[model samples]
Target: MTPSTTHAQHPVGSGFTPASTVDDVLEGIDLTGKNVIITGGHSGLGLVATRALAKAGARVTIGSRDTDRAEQAVSGIGDVEVRQLDLLQPDSIDAFVARYLDSGRPLHILINNAGFPGLGGIVRDARGYEAQFAANHLGHFQLTLGLYPALRAAGGARVVTTTSGAQRVSDILWDDPHFTTGRYDPGLAYPQSKTANVLFTVELDRRWAADGIRAYAPHPGIVPATAFNRSVGEEAQRAMGLIDASGEPVIDPDRGKKTPEQGAATIVFAATSPLLADIGGVYLNNSDISPLDEDPRPVDLTDPDTEVPVDVVPHSIDPRSARRLWELSERLIKSPSA
Candidate 1:
């Protein structure tokens, strides 16, 4: 099946708004006794998501590569637990999932929220995969497949991956997923991983939705000042016009170009909102079904779906490509029925 070009469709009065905060999206939606896991939940939009989910009475577990940073990220969030799981490290993913499953607690929500930004220089993982691709797409791919049994056990569980407007840049370079053959263009590489993110959701949803497991990709919007910017140097930040002449970040660390609270609304809505029960395997932004225009120009400032047009266009979500991508991705990840 092809991915759906339509934005994540929900009822007319789902009570979610463009400016809705995570808390607002979850208002009156109880998550008591639920088990939710958010990667990179220790900081940025993930932290806000953790706070909202926990406050709604769910047991929120955060997966972070750095235990200390993860602990620090959820310090003020109530009843939050942190675990060690770096998406780039396959062994770490396995170990963490083994431990979590050992607890016999079913996983209700798996938010593939952790991601690394583009490091301008050509970098490789231990496996020699491109850093941006490895950390952003492949790592999450491995983690999701590793946790498939747990997700299935949870039944009705949802897996929401954090994709971006950058995905519109290009499709997966199937011949060179590692970027060994071509020049490593940071702009293009980052968008490729994002596109992979959306594709993963599309494929995952198609494969697992019948079992009551659903998948979604969300553009959390442009969040600045998070660790995601660590690889994005000061010069690049300045180049993007995100900094001031004094060299200070124009926005506060807690605040992004958008508020952290507002940035997390879409993910929160996807996780618990009843409005989306019928909508899965789609890309969403600002709590609406985004429209895509094929001929957006440079600096057109279109919706997330239109921003990265390399792989998925307004009409890109068709049955053929969605299923084809699913098969290809499963083969690449060596996932069983991914």
Candidate 2:
């Protein structure tokens, strides 16, 4: 595909659907010698994916800002390892990367699955970058860049980024990435980071295709419940139609609300499916490719006009924007003391 070729989400006939479970996708597939790393792999969809991959015989490593929390969450789970990786801190990210490099392990799959919910006001990183953008986008950007050698050693590694349907909501605020204008909302910051996820994959694939490193950005769907949703609290979730006032999750088929397993199917599929071996830099949903949203439809949930993502926005996956974000990310992730 050409650099300008914007691929739409077209199913590759992978024989899997949105409702497929992690086991369903991994059936008949073997990953005995493969090695993988997933951040935040002890909870939510990340945990589900971690278990599935380990069950398939892959050596799985989980990175968490709170190693104790991660360890406690997976106390009964066998064969998975957890390490310290605070994405918001430059030193922590560097140390984590250096540790992995020194181990001389060939990383076959890297999943940037950890992210914060977009429900808080702007929280800046040490460099003053907005927290959502810094952690969700810039952090992953730095880690991916740092792990290039291990990815290259694998000769055909895959990087799967967990983006959201929210990518359609906002474009990267290039002039003021830190929300310098001071009007911050979880609604805006979250989508900007998600958009970066998609764009980063695009440019990464374009530049690294020859080296056999492919990348993908997939929305895990509107999961009915996950620890990540705590950002919205009970009242807001009730109003958003995610749950009832009685505290039970509302199972809505049309709105794409899914269980954690079902939501995780697409991520595992994107990571392990043979159908995608030749495909890279595509946006996914339902364990298949999703159609591009040429025209964005904003979900008016609140008075200030917050746009929730229903599809991949054109701007988020645009070649120009992807390249621009790549350059900006390279500059932003550098440590001041360096």
Give TM per candidate.
0.85, 0.93
Model 1: per-residue Cα lDDT over 218-331, one tens digit each:
777665555575347787766654566666655432222446787788888878878778778877776544445445446443332233222235433444555666666557
Which 10 residues in a row give candidate 2 its minimum summed lDDT?
1-10
All candidates: CA RMSD (Å): 4.4, 2.9
Tell me how many clashing residue pairs each candidate has. 8, 2
Q: Give Cα-based local distance difference scores for all models.
A: 0.73, 0.84
lDDT of 2: 0.84
Candidate 1's clash total is 8
lDDT of 1: 0.73
Off by over 4 Å in 1: 1-15, 244-256, 300-319, 334-338
